[model samples]
Target: MSPCTFDGALPRALEQIRGAFAGIDFAEVRFIRDMNGRVHLVLPDSADQAEVVAARPHLADALGAYSPGSETGLVRLSDTFFGAALMDEPFLVQDINGTLIRLIERRVVGQDWALAPGTEAGASVAHPPRVSFFSLKGGVGRSTALFLWGRELAAQGKRVLLLDLDLEAPGLGAQLLPDDARPEFGVVDWLAEDLVGSPMAEAMLVERMLVARSPLADSGYLYVAPATGKRTAQHPAGFIAKLARAYLDNDRGGGEDFAVRVRRLLGTLERDLEPDLVLIDSRAGLHETAAAAILHLDADVLLFATDQPTVWEGYRYLLAQLAQMAHIHPAGDDDWRLRLKMVYARASEKQGALEGFRSRAYELWLDGLYDEQPAGGAEDAFSFAETDDAAPHYPLQILNDPRFEQFNPLEHLSTVGAAAIASSFGPFMAALDERVLGNEDLKAVDHAD
Candidate 1:
């Protein structure tokens, strides 16, 4: 098949190949898409190349491409071959139903997504307060909450940078930027251009990517590094291609991994804009971008959750993975646990709703975060209980408000007014100010109705 046809045709090909090779015991099968977008099927060394070539007709029919005498686009799965081609890794893995793939791409920085033993310990603690807003599932108003909180901070005369890391479903740019104010370049553009060794200097890239929001300018600076470039059909052409290329590692020059580049990107923003707080709108669910924000960036993570079974289950998996990391590198002076806080979004003030949600969150935190102590023993000074007011796992509630139901920062700012927004999110903002930002004197503004 042509490269264009192979763009999104992996599932059908996997099903057909599985059916064709049924009952044959193969060690491993890999699906690789090369730089030119051509798809290749990889098999273990034990498989006969001639057999694979003989099955070319079936493979071609499955792939919807007939490239004769091309060895059926088959390659041996080996370290050397894997290293030579600049291709995406772990495209699909074999499962009972043929091949299973995540709806969103997952990127791992190092081996098996685990950091080195001393990496976390050596992380810089002097950077500006970086806060990540995350949710296991969407529609919890994660990004909305971030926009409101960021505006509140800026209004309090604190410089803030709202970063849109949700590249797949970007909305912050539209939500915050006016038609004339949108940046010419965005995070994806910078990464893609850098990958291709563009001559644009770092200063120029920052100038074009970080655009200031005029609405918040009078209070304090609020700059946004949106996910995509200006909202025009002509601009950001080949967005999917740019996204695919952006995720690739810088193996040639700086040799920085994707996570490192992201960190550096934030660092550049912080340095250039000199924002007091950098609030990142992390991608929802378990994605590479989300992992980079949560695991690599030395940021205070505010995990947003609603009272739902699916949300809890997803959080359970995420926390369990984090718990393993905590176990591997037990809490030290600068541990990541110190930076985590839970936010219960869309919380109702009904008799038991808040408590019930808090209870479930506490249980998850206990299982996935808090280090267990010996039974009937004196607890460490820092040991956390479900009810501890000072514990990072404590749930900060954002009471339900109809005004925020259909939240749009630009529209709501004028309609609902900042006072109402602040009042609705009073407790959450207070907790964030006290715990994360270390701003005790600053309070949310109370505009008169």
Candidate 2:
């Protein structure tokens, strides 16, 4: 027999098992795919024990080296923990050639990414509303938009907290915080220490060591939580060590996942700082941690794109993955999809470019996120026309500006003066204010020439 790989393991096992028990009932059987992508089968209580025993060799052969021992490939549901404990675990009805199999998958990463938020629309607590800036490709000006929006809100006398959830690339700290003004610890330290039940996490959270005030804001506040902090600056070598431990599961409290821990941390920061709003700079691309900011946090997620073929293709994959969650177990509110809006970053002035981008985006949303509007069905279906300005696919435009090419807010403050910033980000910020602050009367702060 040939050795089985991950892609072929499930189908081969299903064929072998079905062949071995041709007439047996399999209504309660489940195929479990563990974190490491190994396949195991659990038989229902009604299964024939003698048949299961006799088919062990076939199962072993189907699973190949994965079933090194007699007990590894198969188990009785009644005799194992999977029966009761995994009754509510999410699963997909996968087709192996022609046979349908209920596959329960458990993965250490991307679990939150594939699932939609379970809460109703606007049901979150009274804490400040979160807005995450995300992009599939880097340097699309996602972080710059976050900074500009935070500054704009702060200028309007609103306390804004900017979180750099881009742990791997760690740039927001140096962008805003000067060397002497850096905080003692930052988000990575808080997360890593919290996983091990360290008091330092609480200390850092409570004492403002995890956040710093940016001099860029003089009126209100632009609080920042960088991925790295003063300790990282002092000992650069240990930064990666802390980062490696940051994404681990939290063992201290009910075995919380990484997303839950991030939400808790955000709650702590909101309570401590009492910001008017929170702007999170999410990690660009589909990194595992990006799920926390994009899906789990009760945040309005802004997806950035630059009208490139690669950009649309990347979004196609991301949205198609989300489509699975919507079709499988849609939240009762149907508002989660609305929480995602498109941003045409570095948009061109030519109308052709704008129209082409919008058309492509609308097609993607229609295929992946929008509800199907059947004739004579619900008039309130969550579908929108291609030209609907209110649709999630209709992007808010940010004009291309050469001044922001290599923007450093601290060093190039003159390059992005009020007029320049308003010209580039006016429409985007206006829409953002309406979404976050409910200011419908607001318009673009300045018009681009």
Candidate 3:
């Protein structure tokens, strides 16, 4: 008999339960994962109590010490307060070997990271549209692209607000704002203060000290809400302590998670700045907090990548997690997945590079985000062909240029002149303009307050 462990518990229980219940018509079987990552079985009310009793010895042998405190290694759904209504809840399907099992996850942390945000289809949004620049790995020029675009928009006399959400490895403050121009407080300060119910964490404070105007945008307003501010720099010792508290949910304020808090923060900034566009710089890779920027912000997510094996492998993990989202929340008239787009950053000038990248992206999307279309081809199915230019897998290409290498808009503005910037980022900027500014449909989506 195998000793009880987190990974072994599920298969063992499933085998034993199936062996006992053979041809029984059980309504449902739920395997709940506790905080400790232990598996707990919840049999439906339809399960015969007598059969359960008779199978107790066999179940015990399978479950061992991790039997969820049950002698029989199972609990009837009817025994809990959740009762019959629990059956109505949408439980995620988990594949164990070849068998499918319904799973109810009870997590102490990272729940928001796992679950996708709920979006209202075709809802009218009155506020300015938000766009998030994300990459699986750093040094992909995600932030540089955001800065250039925001500056471009500002040059065209449009107000642009850039928020730095890469809290752990904060650079936007130093990148955008000079030492003298750095804001008194920034996003991290607000989050930490708000967590403690500090009076300083008010909307007025965000408007006054959390935002700083950058010299990069000379024509129009270019506001930045960096990850850290001057105060953090001055008190470097306390920065980590504040950062540790920043990601925590506001339990006292009715359980507002990290995503909700960020949303509120964005709303407050929007209300104050009234920017024409909001560009967010998300933390690189699959950091838990990246979920807030990607899914929760209702932003048009541009997944930045290069044609590299490591990039695809990292994306596979992310897309697999997102695939779960695609399954659990069925697509509506306007699918939320449609908001996701690919950005082939630092793309090679080689003839086959773009095609190769697109092919790999299409395969990843098909395996993950894209819906399964029928052979007959339903008109409204979310799936797309490989050649479809409008598909999420179809990347907006940003070519490899030495001029933009180690780029800093503030410092290397002369090296990457207008012509160089245009040549390198022209296609990407044009597409982004059309998507964010020209697309009235995208701007009109409904978002909750």
Q: Residue 442 deviation, candidate 2, in Å?
A: 9.4
Structure candidate 1, residue pairs in collision = 1-65
lDDT of 3 by residue, 1-449 (tens): 65878778878878888888886433388777767766667787778888777777777667776665545257788876688777765455555676877666676644555555563222234568899999998888888899999988888777789999999988788888998898899889999988877888995364478988998776678899998888988999999999999988787545776877888788878887788789999989887889888888878999999888999999998887777656554445457788899999999998899999999999999877787789999976788889998889999999889877777776887666889888889899999999777854322222232
Top model number, TM-score = 3
Question: Cα deviation of 338 in candidate 1 (Å)?
Answer: 1.9
TM-score of model 2 (CA atoms): 0.85
The alpha-carbon deviation from the true structure for residue 12 of candidate 1, after best TM-score superposition, in angstroms, is 32
Backbone steric clashes in candidate 1, count: 1
Instruction: Kindly list the per-residue Cα lDDT of model 2 for residues 341-362, writing each as its tens digit.
Output: 8999999998698899999999
> After aligning candidate 1 to the native by TM-score, how far in Å is the CA of 7 from where it should be?
30
| Runs off by more than 4 Å, candidate 1 | 1-112, 116-122, 201-203, 206-208, 214-218, 231-233, 252-254, 328-333, 378-383, 439-449
Q: Which candidate is the best by lDDT?
A: 2
Q: Model 3 compared with the native: what TM-score? A: 0.88
Runs of candidate 2 with Cα error greater than 4 angstroms are 1-29, 42-76, 92-103, 119-125, 327-334, 371-382, 440-449
Per-residue lDDT of model 1, residues 1-449, tens digit only:
44326444566556555675675443356655444444566666565666666665666555654222246365554533444242333222223344342211233433224442226432564578889998887778888888877877887877788888888788788788775677777777778877766765374454555455646445766778887756333555689888887777776554766667777778777776777788998888887557777877888888898888988899888776565456334445555677778888998889988778878888887777676667785534235767776666678889888888767766666788767776778878877888776645564433221
- RMSD vs true structure, all candidates: 9.6, 5.1, 4.0
